[model samples]
Target: MRTNIIRDEHVTVSYDVVNGWTVVEVDGDVDLRTSPMIREAVIRLLGEGHRHFVLDLCFVPFMDSMGLGMVVAITKRIREHGGSLRITYTPGPIVRVFEISGLHATYQIYHSPEEATQRTPSPDGLADWPHSPSVKKGS
Candidate 1:
């Protein structure tokens, strides 16, 4: 089930579990104005005992440095608490933001929720689920 914590014109933040991982879907622009909502949503999920995450940013049309900062900060928080974060974004401005900021290499980013869900998280926070057989090692 999907639970929405907040929604407005600028952004909509909601989350649900997929393959035992919390999938937080952001369906709007993520900027200085909207980043906090996303962050707080993740924080709430974390409080609910979620340790694995997939940040689905496919719907985000735009993002700024502040948004990137928020993502990094959120990642740190999750890792600090012994959790894992996977990010997903379409090939567009959102990808551009990560590439320009040189964060694409830092994140376990994917193009779709299906892709993210099918993969394993970082070594420390490995999920109990098995990754897709199609996934080649060290790809």
Candidate 2:
């Protein structure tokens, strides 16, 4: 899988696609400054017919409310189009936040991008693939 770093400060945003699944990896901190870049990338990918996404945030130092909001918004957009979003390789802090806010239940949390991409969508969902786990979350 190829990876691209878009912006970097105390935080960095990178994205890559593998087997039709776009994997977004966020390193450092994801605060107000870098969240917009992440949002834009996801939107662009969606426009390009990439419905399935795996957001890997294992290296992220922190993610504020805005960052979380962006994720939720992207998930909503994908769902509106009968698509799905999966979050994998998230760090403990981010996972705790998602769990506490009940967002974890709303979005599928996977151990790897491959698993996330292979998940079978619901009856009203878009598509699915054979389960082939290949995503590595943390460093």
Among these predicted structures, which one has the highest TM-score?
A: 1
Q: Ten residues in a row with the worst lDDT in model 1?
A: 128-137
Model 1 residue 102 lDDT score: 75
Candidate 2's displacement at residue 30, Å, is: 1.8
Q: Give the TM-score of candidate 1.
A: 0.86
User: In candidate 2, what are the lDDT values of residues 1-139, reduced to their tens digit?
Assistant: 5657576556666777766667887777777877888888778777878776778877876778888888867767776666655677545787777777766655557766666666443434323311221322221
Which regions in candidate 1 have their CA more than 4 angstroms from the true location? 120-123, 126-139
Candidate 1 residues 1-139, lDDT tens each? 9888779988988888888778999998899999988888888778888878988999999999889988978887787668877788888889788878877766667788888887555546523212322232224
| lDDT of all predictions | 0.78, 0.67
Pick the lDDT winner. 1
Local error of candidate 1 at residue 37 (angstroms): 1.3
Q: To one decimal, what is the Cα RMSD in angstroms of model 1 from the true structure?
A: 5.0
